[model samples]
Target: MDKRDYYEVLGVSKTATVDEIKRAYRKLARQNHPDVNKNDPNAAEKFKELTEAYQVLSDPDKRARYDQFGHQATSGNGGMGGFSGAENPFGDFSGFGDIFDMFFGGRTARGPQRGEDLEYELVIDFEDAAFGVEEEIQVPRTETCDNCGGTGAKPGTETRRCTACNGSGEQQNVVNTPFGRMVNRRPCPVCHGRGVIIEQLCRECAGQGRKRVRRAIHIKVPPGVDNGTRLRMPGAGETSPSGGQPGDLHIVIRVRPHEVFERDGTNVYVDVPLTFVQAALGDEIEVPTLDGKVKLRIPEGTQNGTSFRLRGKGIPKLGSQTQRGDEHVRVHVITPTGLSERGKELLRELGRELGESPSEQTRTFVDRMKSFLGNS
Candidate 1:
């Protein structure tokens, strides 16, 4: 069967940007992944198709050739699964590391890895979510010992290389089975993979070269940060046991509910109460905003639920220049109550002048009811 067009398979246009193609490919690949859809038998084939489409379009040269000659440009290449040593047949021959590497920035060279990353949740007020705030927090973590200076030795002592593993930090084990002879390697037990042993242990940290300490970290919260927003602080996590790089510290944000304003993305919504007289005969009203109170012009016949927009009055956009959303102010007309005798008399006179002529809204409702009754 003829293969589908590369752009069509990835659900992208011919003029689609590289970033657009990447995003589309990631979404489709993640959705049709066989592991995610185990009940579907054809999910593997679907994922393979998405992977092939992504592989061709992601490369500039391949994409240009495919665009010029369609599938004929690469028909000479064997079936997608040409590699003999592939572990996964449906993952574009790269297994599951692609997604993790793309999002997590990938790992470093093969060796003793750094410490594990740490995360902490922080709940800030609505004002803080809109505007930035500075906070000092205490974090309990592992730090290099002050006594041994992370060397695990006493003041005048030194460290010696391990003889068992020859300072290579690994031990190889050989086993003979029916298949063949197999060799396995693991961290050396002596010196614990550090390749060195201290003659005299440090008194403060007890030869661990690290100690538990409570550190004070100052964080600068940026404006317009929403819930689930993660902030990364480099080298703020636990120190590596092998003296490598320290992991990062992640801060998750949780914004509290506001009393008057409700935020959706960048926009903000607020309910502004107005008097009946003001609704009938237009008036200027003051409404609350993030910056301050602003005057909103209430046009004549502004009924309940009428909304006005205040441009550039909402929350600021994250990592943008002077870009902001508009604030929507919904009018809620308040009825009169607890009227004095004089006020009642004046209302009675006004009611007589207006007669029983209902407003346009009421007239439309009556017409709809009449139409329904007639049809019934």
Candidate 2:
């Protein structure tokens, strides 16, 4: 069959950038991969064609030559520059493992593997999140066996080389394909890719080389860590079965909501209720903060919903000991209820002295609105 144009095979323009070409190739390759489309008899051939196209277009020198001379520039020995036919089709393909691993799992080799990572959700008080706290947590995980010193073999005996693969830990099978012969390598079934066999198993771990136990771990909760924040502790996860480096423990934080304060990022917000007299006249009132109660000055003629800022009174920035956010306090003026006759008369007299009238109040409100609109 005559070969299709490289650009047409990848469904990209001749002027497409390298990134665009790569994206196009990856999309089509994943869709037509033989393992993904098992029912499609021609999926493998299509994938090979896509790979061949990407192999040429992705290389600057090959692409420049092909642009000038077409397919003849890359043709040699019934292949594209010794990359097809009997040669390994993936020999020059960069990042092949990144795409192929999704379909074929991953490469199996003889070595110690890292342990599995674990995740834990920790619920903490809002104040604890604002000001850093040290917490001790109990985690149940697998630890290296003490009996055999993580070797899986009994104290006196040692592990022997795998008889099935002769310590290589890999088994190869020859596959005949349209391109040519392909060798598929997989882990040895008998040794499970360990390359060694334990003759006398450890009595405590039963040859697993690990035992399950609960351990107490201390974690430092940094300040300004809001809900859903994640903290990673390395080497605090399950022990490696093959005695390799351990994995990590991931902690997800959940901050309990405060009754009086709300947090946004490092900033803190709170609503303080003030009596009508306090809002009309100046007063010094105590306000709650992350540290403790602090006195804030309320200016005379303070209106409802007026916000005041207290500097350096909010949550500390993560990793910063001195830098902190400001706390915003919004005042809500409360109207008095069930007033006494004497109180009502005194209020009326005060209103008269202030020249309170319906028309005057409307005009004043209108003027304030106009001033606000003009400024805006």
lDDT of 2 at 308: 98
Candidate 2: deviation at residue 295, Å? 1.8
lDDT of 2 at 254: 98
Residue 216 accuracy (lDDT) in model 1: 91
Scored against the true structure, residue 226 in model 1 reaches a CA lDDT of 94
Q: lDDT of all the models against the reference?
A: 0.79, 0.86
Off by over 4 Å in 1: 1-112, 158-160, 198-200, 339-348, 357-370, 373-376
Residue-by-residue lDDT tens digits, candidate 2, 1-376: 8889999999999999999998998899889987689899999899988988888998898899899999888788664555644445554333576566555555533367898999999999999998879999999999988898777788999888998999987787765656444456788999877679988999998887778888999999998898999999999988788668888999999999999999988899999999999999979999988888999999999999999999988889988979999999999999999999999988888888998966788899999999999999
Query: What C-alpha lDDT does candidate 2 achieve relative to the native structure?
Result: 0.86
- TM-score of model 1 (CA atoms): 0.64
> Best candidate, TM-score-wise?
2
Listed in order, each prediction's TM-score against the native is: 0.64, 0.81
**Alpha-carbon runs more than 4 Å astray in model 2:** 16-27, 59-61, 72-103, 108-110, 153-162, 167-170, 195-200, 357-376
Query: How badly does each model clash, as a count of residue pairs?
Result: 0, 0
